[model samples]
Target: MYAIGIDIGGTTIKVGLVDGGKIINSNRKPTASTPEEAVANIVLQIDALFEKYNLTVKDIVGIGIGCPGLISSEEGVVCHISTMKWHNFPIVSLLKKTYNTNIKVSNDANVAALGEAMFGAGEKFNNSIMLTLGTGVGGGIIIDNKIYAGAFSKGAELGHMVIRIGGEPCGCGRRGCLETYASATGLTRMTKSAMEQHPESEMWKFVDGDINKVDGRTSFECAKQGDAAANSVVDDFVMYLSEGIMNLANIFRPEAFIIGGGISAQGKYLTDKLTAYCEKYCYGYKNAPKSEIITATLGNDAGIIGAAALVI
Candidate 1:
């Protein structure tokens, strides 16, 4: 049976027809400005998909949605979504009423984790954690082959975990969150700081002195060219990332820790360094089979595939 998967983001809404862990057809549209408009857009997309595939409601098993913010998957309610100004939105019930079908919904990060665990990098392992290091650090945990959203579906906010007592202030109004140091934005900030410190560094040349142009790759690229300042920045970034991973390892001890997002493009270079640091810092690393650190395989389709898995 086929399932429809919808991923709601700040800028876009992605929808797909998924079967057996694969997205058969997909479409994307700009996010609506209001909750009502968003729901209407989703219904329109679902109808379009149905018509395009020549299927009826009975042909689909269910509709699954991955949304941002605090979500109650069981209740199908979006408690709060800062990016979209959605609060206590009854997404599942609304969708169910419109389509008259089974509907499932959960936090976007958690859904992405489920997608990875069921069909991507974590497929081989029963327990795993996925960290998406994009504009911010988004995390998902899987235990015994199932998503583990805490009692209120608010658990697994890994990025908010305080790594330092009085460190950089996070967007979440917290101090020293892991996201402050390990995310793509955080990496750019670090690169900018390094460039400012070493005015003669090659990183400035890479970004042409425009601090805004500096991305997660600026420091790594400059370091590849033997820029000492960039190298130090990378070293510091890896150190903070490894510390966070080690903490997760000691707590969850999952079989694998999967890294997603743009920086993951660094591939083995990133994973190798992270693995080494995790091995050194994780508690009792020598006494047990260490959790492998790897890059996510699903890429952009993770959310769609994962949302579909909620019904499968």
Candidate 2:
């Protein structure tokens, strides 16, 4: 049976039809302006796939969706997604009207983690943490081969984790949140700060006298090109990221730590830095799992793949 996995992101709605752990068909559409309209659009997209594959509802085992914001995955209800302009939407019921088939829904992060656990980087580990480094640091925790959705389906709010009590102000109306320093925007902020402090650093030269060019990639580029200022900013961000992960290691101690999303593409350089930094703060890394930190193998498809694999 083929399963359709859909990920509702703030900017786009991604869907995929999969079988045997591989996505054989997929498509994306701009996210709906309203919850109701969004569901309708998804149904239309699924119908297109159904026709293309020459299959009917009977051939589809299930449909799974993942979205940001608070939600009761067990209940298939969405609650207050500021980024998506959503509030109290009954996603499961809405989708049911269109398919009349079994459906599953979950927070985007959790489902993405599920995808990695079932088919991507965390497949080898029974216990794992999946981090999506994008506009912000999204995440999901899997334990005992099942997602730990917490008591209220709010298990993995990694970006909101407070690394500093009174650091940078976060859009979540909190101060010094980890997302402020560990995300893309965080890197930008750090770069600007670094430039202000070290006006003559090598990074400034690479940025072409434009602070706007000093983004995360620019910082990484400069660091790779041997820029001390950019390296310092990268080090500071990595230090904070590892510091936060240390607490995760001390508690979850998963079999593997899978870093997913765009930012994680930095590869071994990042994992090495994160590991070295985390180890310093870890209680005792000498005998710990050595925490084999690895990048996400599935990339952006983790959420969709995980959603499809939900029925597997």
lDDT of each: 0.92, 0.84
Q: Clashes in model 1: which pairs?
A: none
TM-score of 2: 0.95
lDDT of 2: 0.84
- Report the Cα lDDT for candidate 1: 0.92
> Could you give candidate 2's per-residue lDDT for residues 89-126 as a string of tens digits?
99998888878888988888888898898888888888
TM-score of 1: 0.97
Clashes of 1: 0
**Candidate 1 deviant stretches above 4 angstroms:** none
Where in model 2 is the C-alpha error above 4 Å?
Answer: none
TM-score, per-candidate, Cα-based: 0.97, 0.95
Clashes of 2: 1
lDDT (10s digit) by residue, model 1, range 66-139:
99898998788999988778999998888888887789999999999999999999999999999999999999
